[model samples]
Target: MKPWILGLTGGIGSGKTAVAQAFIDRGVHTVDADHAARWVVEPGRPALTKIVEHFGAEILQADGTLDRAALRQRIFAVPEERRWLEALLHPLIGQEIASVLAHAESPYAILVSPLLIESGQHRLTQRVLVVDAPEALQIERTMARDSANEEQVRAIVKAQADREERLRHAHDVLSNDRDLAWLDREVERLHTFYLSLRGGQA
Candidate 1:
C-alpha cells in the first residue's frame, strides 16, 4: 500500500527545499518531484531520447545531459513547448515518485513538489503543507539563486498558483518569510503534529 503522505509545496523560491530539508533533518523520508523530473531525463533514458528527438542535440550538454538552463529558456519563451515538455515528463515523474513512496518505511512520507497543486499531485497525499512567502521576496530569491533576470523570475512566479489559492487548499501553512531560526522551530512543531497524525490513523 502507498504510505501516508504529506504534500509539501510552494511557489518558486519560497524556500520549499529548506522546509523539506528540515523534515529530512528529523529523519523523514522525502520524495522530491523536481529530482524525479531530472531523473527521467538523464542521458540514455527514454524521456531524454524523446526530448532530443524533439528539441535536437542543442538541448543536451557536452556530457549528453539535458542542458537544463537552455531548455528552461526555450520553454519560458514558448508556452506550447512548456506544455509539451510537461506532458512528457509529468507521468514518468509521477510513476517514479509513487514507486518510492509506496515502499517507504517511514511513519509517513513527505512529497515535495513546486507544482503539487497545479499538476494535481496533491491527490497523492493525505494532507497539503504550503510554504509561503511574499511574491516580491520569491522573485528576489529566485533571481539571486538562479542568476535569472527579474522579468524571467517574475514570469515563473506568475505561472505558479498564487498565494491565496495555495492557502485555500493547504491543510497547514509554513510561513517562510522570516529567519531560518523561526523555520527551524516551526519544523519542530509540525514534525510533532505529523507524528501524532500517523498514530491517529493507526
Candidate 2:
C-alpha cells in the first residue's frame, strides 16, 4: 500500500502537539516540522546564514546560537519579516521532512506543520487533519502554557489563519477544547480510521 502522509496543522496554541503525541503513542511515525525547522537552522546550517543575512547578527546569542526570542520579536513586529523568515525556513524544513518520509516504513505518517496551509507544503501530504479550538481558548492555552501575556499570545495567533480558514483546509477536524479523556478517545478513533484507510477498508 502507498503510505498515507497526513498533514496535521492548526493555529498556534491549538493543541496540535498533544494530538501529535497521541498519534505517537499509537506507534505512528510522526515528522514534526517544528523539530525539523529547529534542526535545520542550527548554528552552522545554510539556513542560518540566510537568516543572519536578512535579520542580522543581533539575532544570534552570545553563545552563537539563534536567539529565537529576538527573532520572534523582530518578525512579529514586521509582517514582511515573518514572511521572509518563513520562506527561508520552510523549504529547508520541507526538504528534511521529505527525506524522512522517503525512509518511513509505517503504513502512515503524520506530518505536524503549523504552517501547512500558509507555507503551501500541505501539497506534500495525502490529507489534511486540523486540530482546532476557539480563538479565546487558543489565547488562554498559549498564555498558560508559555506563561505569556494575552496580547503576546493573541499576536501570534493572529498571524495564523482563523478557525474557519483552518477548517476549510481540513479533510478531518478534531476539536480539542474538551477534556483529556475525550481527546484520547478522539485520537484512538482517528487512529483506527487511519489504519482502515491505509488498509483500503475505508
Candidate 3:
C-alpha cells in the first residue's frame, strides 16, 4: 500500500514552506512542488528541451538553463501563455511526485505546493493541510522574503484564492502568526494526529 500523502498548501506568504520544514524536522518525507518543477527543467532534462522547443531558445540563459525570471514574467504578463506552460509542466511534475511517493519510507508524506488547490492537485492527497496567516501578515512576509514592493506583493496575493476559500479546502489548519514555539507545538500535535491516522501510536 502507498504511504498516506498529505497535500500542503497556502497563499503566497502563509508560511507553507515553514510548515513543510517543520514536518521534515519531525521525520516526515516531504516533496516540494517548486523543487520538483525546477528539477524537471534542469539543463539536460527532457522538460527543458520541450520548453525550449515551445518557447524558443530566447527563454534560455547564457548557461543554457531555463531563464526562470523571463519565463515568470512571460507567464504573468500573458494568461494564455501561463496556461500553456502549466499544461506542459504539471504532468511532468505530477509524474516526479508520484515516483518520489512510490519509494517513500515514512508513514506519511507531504506534497507541498503553493498552488496545490489552484492547480487541483489537492484531490490527489488523502488530507489537505493549510498554513494560514492574516492577509496583512501575508503581504508583509512576502515583501520581506522576496524583496518585493507592496504593489507586487498585493498583485501576487490577488492572483491567489482568498483566505476563506482556502480554509474551505483544509482538513487541518495551522495559524502561523504567533511565534516559533506556537508553531512547534502545533506541529507536534499534528505529528501525533498524523501518527494516529496512520495506525501508529507515536
Candidate 4:
C-alpha cells in the first residue's frame, strides 16, 4: 500500500515551512509544491520555453532565468495572465509532486503548498492540514519576512483563500499566532497523532 499523504497548506507567512520542518525532524518525507513549480520552469525546460513564447523574453532575467518578482507583479495586476501561467504550470507541478510522493519511504508523507485548497491539490492527500493565522498577522509576518511593503503583502492575502474558508477545508489546523517554540510543540502533537492514525492506534 502507498504511504498516507498529508496535504499541508497555509497562506503566505503562515509558518507552513516551520511545521513541515518539524515533521521532517520526525522522519516524515516532504514534497514542496512551490519547489516543483520552480523546477518545471527551469532555464531550459519546456514550461520555460512556453512561458517565454507567451509572455515574451522580457519575463526572463539577465541570467536567462525567470524574473519571479516581475512575473508576480504582472500576474497579480492581471488575473488573466495569472490564469494562463497557472494553466501552464499546475499540471507539470502536479506530475512532479506525484512522482516525488510515489517514492516516499516514510510511513506517511507531506505535500506542502500555499495553494493547496484553491488549486485543488488537496485531492491528492488523505487529510488536509491547514496552518492558520489571522489575516492581519499574516500580512505583518509576510511583510517582515519578505521585505515587502504593506500593499504588496495585502494584495497577496487578498488573492488567497480567506481564513474561514481554509479552516472549513481542514481536517487538522495548526494555529501559528505564537512563537516558534509553540509552533514546534503543536507540530510534535500532530506528528504523534498522525503516527497513531497510520498505525491504526487511533
Candidate with the greatest TM-score versus the true structure: 3
**Candidate 2 on 55-155: residue-level lDDT in tens?**
88999999888999999999989999988888777778889998887777778888898988887878888889999988899888899999999998888
lDDT of 3 by residue, 73-181 (tens): 9898999999998998888889888888778888889899888888778766888889999999999999999999999999889988777888998988998899888
Range of the 10 consecutive residues with the lowest summed lDDT in candidate 4 = 193-202
Clashes of 3: 0
Clashes of each: 0, 0, 0, 0
lDDT of 3 at 160: 89
* Structural similarity to truth (TM-score) of each candidate: 0.85, 0.85, 0.92, 0.87
What is the clash count of model 4?
0
TM-score of 2: 0.85
Q: Which ranges in model 3 have alpha carbons more than 4 Å from their true place?
A: 199-202
Per residue, candidate 1 scores C-alpha lDDT tens digits across 92-200 of 9889899888888878899999889889888888899999998889988999999999999988888788888899989899889999999999999998888878622
- Candidate 1 deviant stretches above 4 angstroms: 73-78, 143-152, 199-202
lDDT of 4 by residue, 144-169 (tens): 89999999999888889887888898
C-alpha local distance difference test of each model = 0.89, 0.87, 0.87, 0.89
